[model samples]
Target chain A: MKTVKVGLGTCGISAGGEKVYKAFQDELKENPNAFVLKETGCIGMCYSEVLIEIKNGSDESVFYSEVTPDRVGEIVEKAILSDDTIEEWLAVKPDNKQNFIDNQTRIVLRNCGIIDPGSIDEYIERGGYEGAKKALTTMTSEDVIDDVIKSGLKGRGGGGFPTGVKWNFTRGAKGDKKYIICNADEGDPGAFMDRSILEGDPNAVLEGMIIAGYAIGSDAAYIYCRAEYPKAIARLRQAIAQAKKKNFLGDNIFGTNFTFNIKIKEGAGALVCGEETALIASIEGKRGMPKFRPPFPAISGLWEKPTNINNVETFANVPWIILNGGDAYAAYGTEDSKGTKVFAMAGKV
Target chain B: MSQQQSDNFKPFNVDLWKYDGQEGALIPLLQSAQDTYGYISEKAIDYISHITGIPAADIYGVVTFYAQFRTKPLGKYVVKVCNGTACHVNGAKPIGDTITDELNIDYDETSDDGKFSLLSVACIGCCSLAPVILINDETYGRLTSPKLRKILRQYKRKVKEEK
Candidate 1:
């Protein structure tokens, strides 16, 4: 059968994606189960939101942009029932937009705008948690750290600290208990990539954290997400519950002695909490204020215990790096910076 | 406290019991209290401070520190104009100016009629739809002065129709 996917990210929803989805639902009621309707995250073509993609079997797909509720009838008639592509409404058929998608590599956003974020089955079908399983069952902690170091992945949170080296510090630190934190407090203006990743493919970040916990000998982790993005939080909650049900999270993961748990701490709309120290302080229920960082979070952080914190984008890249090997990731970008980075590309552009 | 005042925030008190002993629960708890009641009232603050044992002064500090926390009761429609970099570049100020002019209220001020309140926010993360304003949870984006004026009129029409 054919499937109709609607982009329902914050950008899409703000553009009346829900109305369009509802319109399609009303239209499809006549022949129920004739075509499947699915919800997906932002495709990064947010400027042309309310994006609708019609997939005819496996080989052919048509992308329509700037869609409205009025267009749904014609779309259902032409694209779904009649199997005719809407040439004028095509996002890929347009030269500039198609070039935009053609000229870039997408590792972190591989699953975004494609799969159903709420469905763990869709995620697993696309090879989601294999990296975490591989890291836990096959690779040693030192080996995983070495592979990450070799891959040249740095903190995408603007600090540019090496991920493996940071993990090693927590690993070497003298502490009875250590913690891992995923900083989803994307407070910077004009940046919604973190929100998109959390909404689009939360499991990638979760899997990355599970691997990080195993690597750094920490069993507990927290995702410090801002409360502004309610959709992202809701999606993360769904993803975590699904992951736990499938034994992808929680105690004794992957039938190994390793145990890890992930929790979400909603931020109370403080932009300063985007900073590492301020974020840690916010998570601890104190007023989010930054102190000196001589003893970095890797040494003594989060209740004065050893802690490892990485950005949402940083963690989202981890599973890809683990599955595809560090060398494959290192091949992209400049000699100094490895892999790809997602940008907001907002403003007059 | 007056019975009516406490009754206004009865649900907050009922839900506030769960976070009694949980560490780092103050902010989330306060957030829920605000969500239950439109804004964090003085009585709500006192009740929260009494229950959490955090000083009223400290609670006020937290409430004032964060931009999202509203101390006063909101107008029926709270219009949040985005002031992010992209929105600023794309003339977010004129959009704000248009709303305030149409409503006859300044930024962060509510109308005398209590129908609308104008507020400036850092970003709503919808830069692609720059020059955006969120009236309640509904976002109106890519706005010009005329477009915004029309939106404000529609909201005013909503108020009139209700009356």
Candidate 2:
């Protein structure tokens, strides 16, 4: 099928890509035979918002900039149908120079723009659940922990805690009902990186959470997402339902005894709730406020059981690490900051 | 949910007198009224007082406290000149002066033609490229007085072309 990727990143969405996406969806419905419309998270050229990349089989892919609802028909007609490319709107020549792709690495966000967020099959096609499969079948729980440890992936949620160490601590901690939490409460000013990932490719995050649950021997997970993001929440809810339907979530996933389930909790607007301790407090239906963190969440968390809390971006990296060996994933970023960090890059980028 | 979330309160027609009775309800009531109508009108002030059971004198005093809350009708274009420490140091004063001179209106005043309104903001957090002014949501950064003039001229040209 022909592919047309639109930048549904926060910047693009703020600049009316939501309307543009709807317009394209409605337009493509009429001419379903020739085209397929897809949504991707930010490719980092935010200055040129509503960025669109169109690819047909024989022809080279082209990137279009500043796309609007009005221009959707023209882009569909010209770029998708005829060979006549619109020069005025083209941002970069995909064939001659992949300037957008070459400058930045895409480890955490590898499956972000490539996969349909709500569809599990598209995620599987892009090597999504291979990590969970490997973790389940080939690698032992200890081996999975060791791979994460060697990868040196730090939390992108401002804390910079070692993911492997946290998982190891949770594994060592004694508990009957341990839980893994994905903190999607991204309340930092000018930060929508978490929201974009959740909106674009949610299953990557879910798969990562499941892998974490498997490693720590947890049977349940909770994704603490903020209520402000109605769209992201809706997509995540749909993704969770889809995962359960495909047996990726409920009992005996992929024909193994490791059963896991995930539920979504909407956060009341609180900036401090992004703190893990505060997030647990909010999840327990208390007033959202931060408490001292000595007996951390790993020891005594969420209903007094060992809980692992990783941010949206950190969980996004998990599936990739498991699928593409830990060493391969570790070769991307600086020594101190290993692996790719997906920033919102808002305000003046 | 609090008692305020209840729908028993009338849609509008607030009394200004009862606003002074409550301590913190004044700001929220005014904010709710302002959010309903783009700018807080006299009718909204009456509505706020009627709903919150507070005095109008205290309600008006509270409106003057916050920079974001406006009493008068704002113009179509809200020209917010950044007066934060960085913006102030990097020639934001001159840009503000140019706008005041061109519009013949002081800060927080709308033009008689309803085309422009001028206000000073704390910061837009684009300090790297300081001396910025956000016309509506778009930030025009690294601004000199001459650049500000040229930008205003472009707006005027667009207005004239439309006319």
Candidate 3:
């Protein structure tokens, strides 16, 4: 059986993806057994949203770009029913938009636009929580921290700080309780990378957070997401619920002595909260104003406890680094800067 | 307040208990009030201050500090123009100008009839579709001044048809 997937990310929805999905439903209702319909997230192609994809057993998937309600009939008739290809609508055909994904390494966006974001099974099928399992079950906290340091992963939230060093400091800090914060307060104007990841592969981010919790000797975590990205928040809420049910989060995960819990703190449209200290203050119900950096969150932060904060993109890279080992990630970029960077390219050009 | 204005006030009844004594609950409480009432009124601030034990001055300060919070009531349709770098480069100013000229109101001002309010946001995260404007939740992108003018006319026609 073939499956029909629609892009339902914010960009896609803004481009009338809901209408297109409704059209597909109306067409497929007569033959309910014809194709399985599913929803996916952004493929980083905000320009050509309302994207539809057709997939068969092991064959290469096909993508149709800028698909509308009016065009749903043609796609259903030609692609799904007849099992034929349409060249003009194809987004990944030769000499077309193929280089968009081909030219880049997509570790953070690996499951985005491919797997159903709402399905935890789909995420696990893509090896989602294996990193957290490996960290909690096999490797020691210091060992996990060492692997990250060897992997040379730095914070992807534009500051370029060494992530492993930050984790080491938080782990070394003498505090009764430690906290891990996944900074999802992406306030930068052209940046939708964090939003896309949160909406697309939320499990990966959750797993990443769980691993970070284990590494930093923390039992509690918070995702400080902005209120602007409602879909991202919904997805995170759903993912957290699913993980809790499966014992991936909350109380002795993976049958280990370590217990970790995650909570979501929605930023009330404050741009300054993107700063670590400001974000900590906002989470504390105070005004989101920047403070001195000597405390630096790793030592005394977040209700005066030891805290480690990493960007959404930085946390998204954790599971991958844990499973693949640090050397595999270090193989991607220059000596100083390892792995790929996600850029929000926008403007007149 | 007039009878009509008093009648329009609906108490924010959703999850008020969740924030009763929670620290860091001030912003979320204000956000809930904003979502329910469209704008944060003085009475709402007073109620929130009373409930959360935050000073009314502090609550007012926080409300004015964030661009998302509005003290004034918004129009039925809130038109947010994107003024990000990409949108700016792609003639966002002209689009905003067209909205203001057609609506007969400047940025951050609602029409006297309360039909439309104009706001300029940093970005809507749809930079690929530059020069975008969001009316409530719907996004109109890749827009020209003429196209925006036509869109505004359609919204105006909607109000007229209702009348």
Error of 3 at A165 (Å): 0.8
Q: Compared with the true structure, what per-residue lDDT tens digits does model 1 show for residues A1-349?
A: 8899999999999889999999989987887877999999997799888898888888577789999999999888888888788899987785565466668789999899999889989989999999998899899999999989989999998899999999999999999999999999897888999989988898989999999999999999999998878899999999999999999887889999888899899888888999989988888877899989878989999999999999999999999888888999999989999889999877767
Show the colliding residue pairs in model 1: none
Better DockQ candidate (2, 3): 3
TM-score of chain B of 2: 0.74
Per-candidate interface DockQ score: 0.67, 0.05, 0.60
lDDT of 3 by residue, A1-349 (tens): 8888999888888788889999989987887877889999887777778788899877568888999899899888888888789898987786665477778788888899999999999999989899999999999999999999998899999889899999999999999999999999887877888988998889989999999999999999999998878889999999999999999988879998889999998887778899999999888877788899888799999998999999998999999999999999999999799987777676643
List per-model TM-scores for chain B.
0.89, 0.74, 0.91
Ranking by TM-score: 1, 3, 2
Candidate 3 has an fnat equal to 0.56
Best by DockQ: 1
Quality of candidate 2 docking, DockQ: 0.05
Mark the regions of model 2 whose C-alpha exceeds 4 Å error after superposition. Answer: A25-32, A93-98, B1-163
> Which lDDT tens digits does candidate 3 get at residues B5-108?
24366666647536757677888888878777778889898888888778999999888877788988888888999898788989998998898899998998
**Candidate 1, chain A: TM-score?**
0.98
lDDT of 2 at A152: 87
Q: Chain B of model 1: TM-score?
A: 0.89
Per-residue C-alpha lDDT of model 2 across residues A112-143, encoded as one tens digit per residue: 66666767888888887888988998888899
Order the numbered candidates by lDDT, best leading. 1, 3, 2
